[model samples]
Target: MAITSIFNDAFVLTWDFILTIVDAVTPSHPAGHVVPAGHPGAGGEWPEYVSPGEGDSRCACPMLNAMANHGILPHDGKNISFKTMNETIRSTYNFSPSFCYFVPNYIARALDKDYFKDTFDLEQISVRNDKGIEHDASLTREDVRFQPDQGKPHIPFINELLATASGKDTSAEDPENALMLTSDDLARYSAKRRTDLENIGGKLDFIHKMFGSSNSATLLRIVGGHVSDLRPFLIDERIPDKWEPAIRSRVGLTMARFNLTVLPLEFSTRKHMKALAKAKKSG
Candidate 1:
């Protein structure tokens, strides 16, 4: 069964999914800031030894596609072992993005927890700070970690095998499938983009301000500003004059009620349902 199907049900809200998300977003850099660099074409000759085209491939990782081709990764996307998977990934590239480190681990844990019915005990460790006071940090067999290399950057490798297997495209571009969006499509995309930014900025800016400053907030501000630039192009007399503010207000209301405004509605609802289920079970 697909990982999504396993976790999609309200009754199936396992800790595995939440833990995987946590592991995925965790900083992989040695300094715990900035995503390490590596794009698709830099690492290896992914889909048969060839050269990168005019621009970088928009695909996630060629190495991952190569893994799927070689049968080192499971065809069914289940029954993965982190030790085995990590060794393969490490051997493939000398260095990669921090986010790439734990994705396979996350997939392995998700598959084990949901389909294979495996269990693990969290281990505790103590470490002393500069003040010489000790704090506890939980340890696990599976974890997110950084593999740093001061070299060329690459694209973050996503766990595509966990989702579905697709035919490896050796060519740089899939000519048959490469149709750019039209002007109207761009307009709609821009409108949606503007609304999303305003929502995210209005809701999170206050909290981010409270915490002083963060890379996350800075990035949001940058992206939000860019989206704001596209506002006039995307909206006009056809759209409501108050459309932007109204959308932001709706986002704030949703955030206040549910503590989420950025995620897609289906995903947010499912996440909330899962959290409620977890709370009820613990209570």
Candidate 2:
């Protein structure tokens, strides 16, 4: 069934915050009614498909079932997309979920309400080929806010706070500013990150700096994205003991995900982590 996002005004956004929000889909849904999983098998996926624009070859009808399931399908209205989904999630949450959960929901939430189509059963849709039987590949103007006269096609980043690192020139997208960290900067960033995690008080930028970048916190901030930056802590499991294994597992998964090079490599996405790991997307 199409699900109404529970992340709406949810003060407590744990991994479930995103698990409940992202429609049960992944960048991996080959030859059915979603983005064709770039690789050929269940084990295959473009690791680089992590960022937006790097690869977003969706089925054009990305959320047909989701729309029908929610009874908010857009064909009667329009269609859902990154822009539309971002708007949908934003219309309710005001901020993206941040970290790995940040991007999917950001893209899922961007669409205007009009694109929220009615849902349908997967069994009913014909999927004999990669494109499916009759899904329209053409995106309507309503689906995307296309400029009549193009100067430059500016598709904004869904997770503006998301820092991309694809071995490409990031100078144009994200300019590097030398940060002089004083004791004061450390104190502030440290304190803020703690509060957000413990639900006392905090700032998202604190998490951003830990990731070696500085950006405002939004729903699209995927804490998992920054896992690579935490080297020593993971080497020693420095996470606070009071945190539940579930929570610890989440941090570990986030770390493991971005830190894919680590040893004892996990062989499955379905195991060895918290439910939250499912929410993390490199993008």
- The number of the candidate with the highest lDDT is 1
List model 2 lDDT by residue over 44-156, tens digit each. Answer: 22111111122222222222222222332232322334344433322222222333344433223332122234332222232223322321111111112233211111223
Clashing pairs in 1: 37-153, 37-154, 38-153, 38-154, 38-155, 39-154, 39-155
| Cα error of candidate 2 at position 76, Å | 22
Structural similarity to truth (TM-score) of each candidate: 0.21, 0.20
**Which sections of candidate 1 miss by over 4 Å?**
1-66, 75-78, 93-101, 108-283
* lDDT score for candidate 1 against the true structure: 0.27
Best by TM-score: 1
Model 2 ranges with Cα > 4 A deviation: 1-12, 15-41, 45-102, 114-283
Model 2 score (lDDT):
0.25
Report every candidate's CA lDDT: 0.27, 0.25
